[model samples]
Target: MQVILCEDIDKIGVAGETKSVSEGFARNFLLPKGLAYPATPGNLKKWESEKHLREIKLVKNLESARTLAAQLESVALSVPARAGREGQLFGSITTAAVAEALLGKGFSVDRKTIDISAPIKTLGAHEVTIRLHSQVEARLKVEVVSS
Candidate 1:
């Protein structure tokens, strides 16, 4: 039996793909679980149109991510922290603080998206990576200054 997959099945096929399977498997497992639909002429036509729309949406999303990445790369953030006579800070700069600083600059960034390999403890320039999208990443300089 031929069926169009609605969702990706491990070892079988991905979503929006047509695959051949046993009649029993198609009727019992794929149909009952709503994982696939029988590939009739009408269904094939519907899937083609839906596939085109999905491609368009993916292109738009990629463009948007690239734009955001460019904007983020040019931004330099300054974070103020209380420190002693030396350059050592009383506390480390957290991901939440970075997100807050970005929010202050009119960019609503999520703390989870900011990747800091280690806690910032010194008062100097540091590199921070922001995962804006799966295909896009932006690196920005974070300057920590004593308040």
Candidate 2:
């Protein structure tokens, strides 16, 4: 069966993509969950138009993300955490903490967008990558110091 994806599906495809899948899967899973619609002629046309608009929006968002990235590059964020004598924190600093630090620096970064692979265990300076958009990424210097 042919279906148009209404949202991004991991291991499948992005929104507005038309793809073929098993009829049972399309009807039972994707359609019921509102993740996709049957790729009829009307729906396909609608999807095409929606895809064009989404592309334009994505371009504008990417430009804004680039500007934000530039601003983030110039600022260093400090995170205060409880640490031992060896400068190892009792609990690691997570992306949520980084996002909070960014907020303190006047950047409204979403925690989901701040890509910290693992929590910072040792207290020191670390570079964290913030994914502002699919194409725009920025490095933020995070200084973890004792409180």
Candidate 3:
């Protein structure tokens, strides 16, 4: 039996894959478990149409990411933190803190999207990378100062 996988199945196939399996296996395991559907003409056509639509949506999302990246480049973020005798921060400037600061500055950003190799422990100007999309990234200037 020919089947189109709806979701991944270990040792069998991944989603959007077309595979040939035993009729008994298809009827008993794959179909009953809602893991796959019969590879009919209508289903294939529908899948192709959905795939095209998804590609268009992804392109639009990528464009939006790029647009955001451009706007973020000129926006310098200042984060206020308590420090000790030295300029070193008491704790650290984290991604969440940076995201919050950006939000305060009227730029919405997700904490998880802020990529920091190391926590900002010292106070100074730091360049941070913000991942808006897998292909789109923005360089952010962050200045940490004593509150």
Candidate 4:
């Protein structure tokens, strides 16, 4: 069956894309979920007209992501925590903590987008990765100080 996707589906296709799939799958999952519609001639023409708008929106999003990435690169975050004499933190720093710190700095970032490779149990400086977009990433400098 031929379908035009209204939303991006993993392992399938993106929005405004036309694809072929098994009839049963399209009718049962995609159609019922409102993720896609039958690829009729009228729908195809409508998609062709709206394609330019989608492209423009994508370009704008990419530009904003790049700008955010640049700003994030220049930011240095300090997180104060209770620590022992040996520089080990009483508790580990979490992604929620990092997100809160970023929010205090006037940047609204989701905690899920922040990636820390290991548990921050020691007090020092560490690099964290923030995924702003699929094509843009920024390394943040986080300094952990004893409170």
Candidate 5:
């Protein structure tokens, strides 16, 4: 089955894209959830017009994300946590904490955007990646210290 995506779906495609999928999956999941529509001739034409509008909106959003990424690049966040005598933190620093720190610095970034491969356990400086867009990524410095 062919369908037009109305929003970005991980492992699938982005909005305004036409993709093929199993008929059962399309009919039972995507179409009912409003994530996509059947790729009929009328819908395809509609998607063509919507694509231009979506492109413009995405461009603006990407620009904003880039600006935020630039601000984030210069920030050094300090995360304080309880630690043991060996300097290992009692609990690991998570992406949620990183996102909160970024929020404290005036950036409205989601936790999903933070790409921490592993939980931060030691008390020291670390580099983390913040994904602003598919093509825009920024590195942030995080310093973990004893509270």
Candidate 6:
């Protein structure tokens, strides 16, 4: 039986793909689970249009991420913390703090998206990586100064 996959099936086919399966599998499993639809002429036409729209949306999203990454590169952020005479900070800078600082500067970023490999514990410029998207990463400079 010929069917159109509505969702990806591991080891089988991806969404928006047409595949041929055994009659029992198509009728009993795929149809009942809504993983696929019968590859009729009408369904095929609808899937093609939808797949084209999906591709356009993906391209737009990638463009948006790239622009954000470029903008972030020019951004300079600071965090104030109390430090000793030797310049070791009393407290540490965290991902939440970085997000808050970004929010203060008109950029709303999630804390989880700020990838801090280790807690910042010194009084100097630190490198922070912001994973804006799977394909985009922005290196942010966080300068820690004496409060």
- For candidate 3, report its TM-score: 0.70
| Model 4 lDDT tens row, 1-147 | 999998767689888889999999999999999999899999899889888998898789889999999998899899889999999999899999999999999999999889999999999999899988766888999999998
Candidate 2 lDDT at 44 equals: 84
User: What lDDT does each candidate get?
Assistant: 0.89, 0.88, 0.89, 0.91, 0.89, 0.88
Candidate 1, position 90, lDDT: 95
Name the candidate that leads on TM-score: 5
C-alpha RMSD of candidate 5: 2.1
Better of 3 and 4 by TM-score: 4
Sort all candidates by lDDT, best to worst.
4, 1, 5, 3, 6, 2
Candidate 2, residue 66: lDDT: 95
Query: Model 1 misses residue 3 by how many Å?
Result: 16
Q: Write the per-residue lDDT of candidate 3 for residues 39-145, one digit (tens) a residue.
A: 99999888777877767777898899999999999898899999988888889999999999999989999998898877898989998999887678899999999
The C-alpha stretches of model 3 lying farther than 4 A from their native spots are 1-45
What C-alpha lDDT does candidate 1 achieve relative to the native structure? Answer: 0.89
Clashing residue pairs in candidate 6, if any?
A: none
Higher-scoring candidate on lDDT, 4 or 6: 4
Could you give the candidate ranking by TM-score, starting with the highest? 5, 2, 4, 3, 1, 6
lDDT of 2 at 88: 88
RMSD of each: 7.1, 3.1, 7.1, 3.8, 2.1, 7.4
Tens digits of per-residue lDDT for model 6 on 1-147? 999998767678877889999999999999999999999999999988798787787679778988988887789899888999999988799999899988888888889889887889998899999987656889999999999
Tell how far residue 141 is off in model 5, in angstroms.
Answer: 1.0
